[model samples]
Target: MKKSDVLEQIRKIGLVPVLRAESESQALALAGAIADGGVTCMEVTMTVPGALKVMARLAKERPEILLGAGTVLDAETAKECVGEGATFIVSPAFDEKTVSYCRAHEIAVLPGALTPTEVIRAWDAGADVVKIFPASAMGGAKYLKSLKAPLPNIEMIPTGGVSLATAHEFLDAGAYALGVGADLVDTKAIRGGHPETVTAHARKYMEIVKGFQAGCLI
Candidate 1:
């Protein structure tokens, strides 16, 4: 997909599920469950065992899903993930070389940032979107709102504290999209043979996103 199109889908969907699993098989199962629940875009964190294998399989088997690589700390790792079919690169913190590489490759990059300075630095470094990592630590939606006030031109994806309970608040804070982890991914439920639990969570989040977007349209 074109870089522009990938970013458009992200904003349209308004939710990016962050996937992390203990095993490759479990990761696949979690991905399947999330897709079944109506979320087709996700960030597969490198922390998962056999992360490249998982990304390859997902890219080959599920062409409809938008796959991204997360926890990418360096350009080398980002290159490897892209080779495995990651359309986007996501890092927990800003790395100039990694961001530069993605930009040079025409791939979407969302590097994480927290403070105002880091956020600006990431944006200035050409990040398509700055991900506010561990957003809960800085007061969640309120913090995001503060960032958006002056940096309104910069897009941001708030991660680490988004839940069904707070997704709406994040959207209201002018977040470009949400980065949801355990709350929506639900690996435990998948391991317990309840993939439906994940699907249900996806449905709930989708409902929130769709509802918010619909309101915006009106």
Candidate 2:
């Protein structure tokens, strides 16, 4: 998908499921569960084992869902993930090399940033969006809201401590979208071999987010 299209989809969905799978099989199942729950965007973090291979499988098999690689720290991994069919890229920390690599390749990049300086640096580095990592530590929605006054143009995705209940608050506070991990996709449920539980949890979050978007609670 085109970068513009991917960004638009992320804005529409309001939340992107972040998955860390121990194996390819588990990743496949997680992808299916998220997709089934009405969320078509996912971020597969490289922290998990076989992340690249799992990302490749999801890209090839689940063409309907937008696939992104998260926790990307360097140029090599960024290049490999994009080549393997990552529609977009995300990083835990601001990395100039990684951002430059994505920009050179014309792939969308969302590098994690905290302060205004870091956020601006990421944008200046050509990041499609700046992820506010551990946003809760920075004061969550209130922090994002504070930045809007001075840096309204910076697109941000608040990850870490973003829950289904507070997802809309971040969006309303000026976040472009949210990168949800454990809150949306229960790792314990998945590890327990209850993929359906994951699906159900995803569906609940999706409904809450979609409802807020539609301006109808019920």
Candidate 3:
């Protein structure tokens, strides 16, 4: 997908399920389940074993899904993930070199930032979006609201501590989108052969997103 289009889809869905699995096969199963639940976008964190292989398989087999890589730490790792078919890259810390490389390659990149300074720095370096990592630690949606006040032009995706209960709050706080893990991916559910749990969470979150965007909810 085109870089801009990828970003558009992300905001439209309003959720990116952060899939981190213990095994490649489990990761694929969980990702496939999420897609089946009607949310086709996911960030497969590099922490998963054989993550690149998982990305390659999904890219080739599930071309319709918007698959990306997460937990990318450096330029070299970012390059390798993109080569393996990651349409986007997410890092826990902002690395100018990686951000610049993604900008040059036309791949969407969401580099992590905690403070307003880091957020702007990443944006200036060409990040498509600044991921506020460990977001809840710094105050979750309330913190995001504070950042949005002055940095209204910058897009922020609040990761960590995002759940169905708080997804609406995040969007209401002006988050571009949310990078959700346990609440949506639910590792234990997947491990127990209950992908249904993942799907249920996706469906519920999607409904909330739709409601929020339509202004049907506060």
Best by TM-score: 1
Q: Is candidate 1 or candidate 2 better by lDDT?
A: 1
lDDT of 3 by residue, 1-218 (tens): 79999999998888888999989989998998888888888999999999999999999998878888999999899999999999899999999999988988899999999999999999998999999998999999999999999999999999988998899899989999889998888788888989998888788988888888888445
Comparison by TM-score, 1 against 2, better one:
1
Off by over 4 Å in 1: none
Backbone clashes in model 3, listed as residue pairs = none
Q: lDDT per prediction?
A: 0.95, 0.85, 0.91
TM-score of each: 0.99, 0.94, 0.97
- Model 2, TM vs. native: 0.94
lDDT of 1: 0.95
* lDDT (10s digit) by residue, model 2, range 153-215: 889998987887788788788878888888766667777888888788888878877777777
lDDT of 3: 0.91
Candidate 3 regions exceeding 4 Å error are 216-218
Which candidate number has the best lDDT? 1
Ranking by TM-score: 1, 3, 2
